[model samples]
Target: MTTVAYQGEPASNSSTVARTLYPAGSELPFTSFEQALDAVTLGAADVAVIPVDNSAAGRVADVHHLLPESGLFIVAEYFLPIRFDLMAVSGASLDRLECVRSHVHALGQCRKVLREGGWRTLVSDDTAGAAREVAELGDPRHAALAPPAAAELFGLRVLRSAVEDDPDNTTRFVVLSRAAVPAPHTGEPTMTSLFFCVRNIPSALYKALGGFASSAVNLTKIESYQVGAGLNASRFYAEIEGHPEEPRVELALQELRFFSTEVRVLGVYPAHGHRRTERSG
Candidate 1:
């Protein structure tokens, strides 16, 4: 079976996506996103599933900063509906719980329940990891906010289901592999991810992005961050609806190159179905 690496414990959301994408693959959990990506880069795993953003919690990881240098290609994307449950040791009553533990984002998402229960919050590295910790501690005074599936995985009892404030919470993940797959030139809705650094010249960014507007290329996402110690040297990660080799996309990129010090295509893959759902709504 192929091995899939993901950050967080066995039942974390990334692992959930890995299972959905590669059901037959073995899962290897890592303490951090860097470690999981490294596993793919070092040939220890076939692919890595990483959470990039969440609708409720905003950006989950700084993938914009990591992907440009990871030497990995985005092979696919997955959207996982996030659901957090309050779980505790079997036979542990809700009244006995003093504090709840989960990843910071999970805790934030479940604030309503935590506030209603008057439970203190503790931050763990991951949601499922918090469940594991709660199980190992075997404390009636402690509970965890994680996926309901985690209750079975970690031998806990779910005290409350779907505790998140938003019923429509969802997370976007990307599958990374050592080498790029040939994204089809046609037949499926495609998305291309790229990183570009604007030239020092004034309005370089405005000039670089103007072509997309003129070409009617839809930019799905764009994010900017400073590179190392160079405060003025900012790099932008962008996702566009067209492939790099397509005529209009090519023309837009040519203009980008003229105004950018560097322009690198990170991936060109099929857009996830969830994107269509989001757009329709």
Candidate 2:
């Protein structure tokens, strides 16, 4: 069976997406995104499934840098709606709880719930790990904030379902493979993600982006991230709609060459649809 490497405990959203894509693959868990990429690069796993963004955490930079350098290519995509639940040992009550345990992200998402309930919260490294701790401890006063699936997996009972601060939370996942796969939706509206460095000059970015404007193409997203250590250089990652061969898209990239230090087209894939927010926890 092919092995899929994911960065998180078994019940994490990343692992959930991986299993959805490669139902028959052996799942490998890594403590970090870098390690998951290592598994794919060293042939320990056939592919790595990772989250790139969450409605809550914004962007996951780990996947951005690690993927570019690993020589692996993103071959597929998945969007998982996020949900968090307040879980405790079976038959436990919320009023009896002392402190709640959860990942930092989860803690933030469940802030109001904990604060209003007069429960102290402890940040743990993983959501399911925290739930497992609560299950093993079997303390009536102990509770964890995790996904409903995690509560079920760890045999904890859900004290209250869908406790996240935002009901619209969703995370986008990318599946990478050693072998490059052609852009998935040649005929469908697609999104292309790429990074480029612009020369430090007035109007440099404006000149580079003007081609898209002249062609009536929309630049959907743009963000700058730092590269290099102490004497830092910055690079920009952008997402645009359309194929590379489209005249406007071609000219935009060509224009970028005159102003950019480097340009890399990371992936071109079907655009993600509007996140199903009401489904979030």
Candidate 3:
């Protein structure tokens, strides 16, 4: 059986994605993202399911910094609709709850409920961990904001369901493996993720990105981050909506490489169906 690694307790969003992707696989949870990625790198696990960003919370993990340094390649992407529940041990009453606990992101995502309740907040390492803590505390005064599955996992009762501030909140997760598995260029929707550093010269970034404009390539996302504590250079992580093997994409990359000091293709995979669904909606 396959062993899937993720950075959360069972029933956390990452765990849910891993289970959905590999139902028969065994799950291995780690305390941190780096540990989960390391498991895949050291052959302890086949792959790691990691959250990259959330529509409500912005970035969940520092993937831009972590991915480049981990030497892992993205194999696939999954979009999960986020849902948080207010849960506590059996016999806990919503009216009696005085404090809320969850991962920082979960607390942030459920701001509407938190604001209405006006409860004190405590940040835990992960949502499931918060649920487990609530269960262990056995206090009706302390409730947790956690995934629905987490309520069942830790035997906590759901006092409120789907408490996220935004009904359409979603998180984007990436599957990482130690080796590259670029999807075949079969003309379907595809996403190419890459990292590049432009040479430190006047208009270097502008020139580096001009190729995409000239080639009519659609860049879905681009974000620049400082590297090595150096103000003179910056690294960019970009996602473009085409396979690198395509002619126009190839031409754009050729131009990009000419102006860049370094360039690395992180992954080229089939775009998630959610991308189309989201756009059409």
Q: Give all TM-scores, in the order shown.
A: 0.97, 0.89, 0.98
What tens digits encode model 2's per-residue C-alpha lDDT throughout 165-200?
888787788887787765754566666777788887
Top TM-score hit: 3
Number of the top-ranking candidate, with lDDT as the measure? 3
Clashing residue pairs in candidate 3 (N, C-alpha, C atoms within 3 angstroms): none
Report the Cα lDDT for residue 143, model 3. Answer: 97
Query: How well is each residue in 155-255 modelled by candidate 1, as lDDT tens digits?
Result: 99989999999999999999999998959888578989999999988888899999999999999899999976755868899999988878898999999
Off by over 4 Å in 2: 229-233, 275-281
Please give the lDDT score at residue 281 for candidate 3: 93
Query: Residue 114 CA error for candidate 3 (Å)?
Result: 0.6
Q: What is the lDDT of residue 189 in candidate 1?
A: 84
The clash number for model 2 is 0
- Quote model 3's TM-score: 0.98
Q: TM-score winner between 2 and 3, please give it.
A: 3
